[model samples]
Target chain A: MNIRPLGDRVVIKKLEAQEKTKSGIVLPTQAKEQPQMAEVVAVGPGGLVEGKEVKMEVEVGNKVIFAKYAGTEVKYDGIEYTILKQNDILAIVE
Target chain B: MNIRPLGDRVVIKKLEAQEKTKSGIVLPTQAKEQPQMAEVVAVGPGGLVEGKEVKMEVEVGNKVIFAKYAGTEVKYDGIEYTILKQNDILAIVE
Candidate 1:
């Protein structure tokens, strides 16, 4: 029931796109853009990847901004998640 | 001027697509398919990239097969080449 990414990969749950305006007006579904923000669900055990030594920097529950159009989309238990390599992540959000 | 790729990257010159038939007939330009094979032109210094320790594996003059649509196409001194990360190279042709 859980996904364990392998070798420098990470499993992330995308933060829901903001659908409400600053004035609390709800925007339509078509107006909601896919957010690049996500919470790290799992971190891969970093070791030898493509002959390189990789060390995982991000930890579980950390918010991050990832590259657009990167990673694979997967559905588990009716929940959508993205699995991507650590390099695809641009920055960790505080 | 020659291009020198940066860290963990490689510059490769794509091999010319076969333009002749086995029967010694010359095929039209439109019939030529892009070849995936290339000769390594320059290799980046092996070092820290994306927080990982990457070691350069391929060397200059080595023929390698790279992933399709990988790397950035660049023209230098009237010649075309591709600059891509080392991971984008799939295998070295013996």
Candidate 2:
């Protein structure tokens, strides 16, 4: 399913978390935390401030690091999508 | 301890979660989720685009809503702080 964000929001598809620990120990799903990495899919045109349009810095296909607990989670066609503001993005991976 | 972020990062202090549920039942800490509300304590001087300096849109003391899982967690002087990029912020409360 296609999803689009309104305003300065963006839609991200989270990367899957590692199933094994650094020590090579396997962890159960309940023991695993949400992944903090995501790929930018769709982004809003930009944010508005004082009736002026502010353009976005990040673009589609950028791999970004974000907070573990940021964004609203939604399920569409059995796929999960995150809606986050532009500022929530921590860094863009080159 | 005072903490300031470098670059386009911002420091946020998470608001305390409600101790009681809407039904007035007390929930255990394990069952409680992290609070999504925060106050912006500091912000970076905008982000660099192609080596050009950009100014920030938000300022200190802005009550902002961010993604539930964005930012890096740090502890200093027995207090917790989150370092997030300017884009991670969803909205500023007026």
Candidate maximizing TM-score: 2
State the DockQ, from 0 to 1, for candidate 2: 0.05
Give the local distance difference test score of model 2: 0.63
Residue A51 local lDDT, model 2: 59
Model 1: per-residue Cα lDDT over A25-93, one tens digit each: 221333122226678999999888888777677799886655546899999998989999987764454
In model 1, which runs have C-alpha deviations exceeding 4 angstroms?
A19-35, B1-47, B50-94
Q: What is the DockQ for all candidates, taken in turn?
A: 0.04, 0.05
Q: Show model 2 residue runs off by greater than 4 Å.
A: A19-35, A49-53, B1-7, B10-94
lDDT of 1 by residue, B1-94 (tens): 2454555778788775562232233324453442377889888775777656789999998978776467655443457667688999988876
Residue-level lDDT of model 2, residues A21-69, one tens digit each, is 2212221333133226577889887656345455576678886656556
Cα lDDT over the full model 1: 0.69
Error of 1 at A59 (Å): 0.4
Number of backbone-clashing residue pairs for each candidate, in the order shown: 0, 21
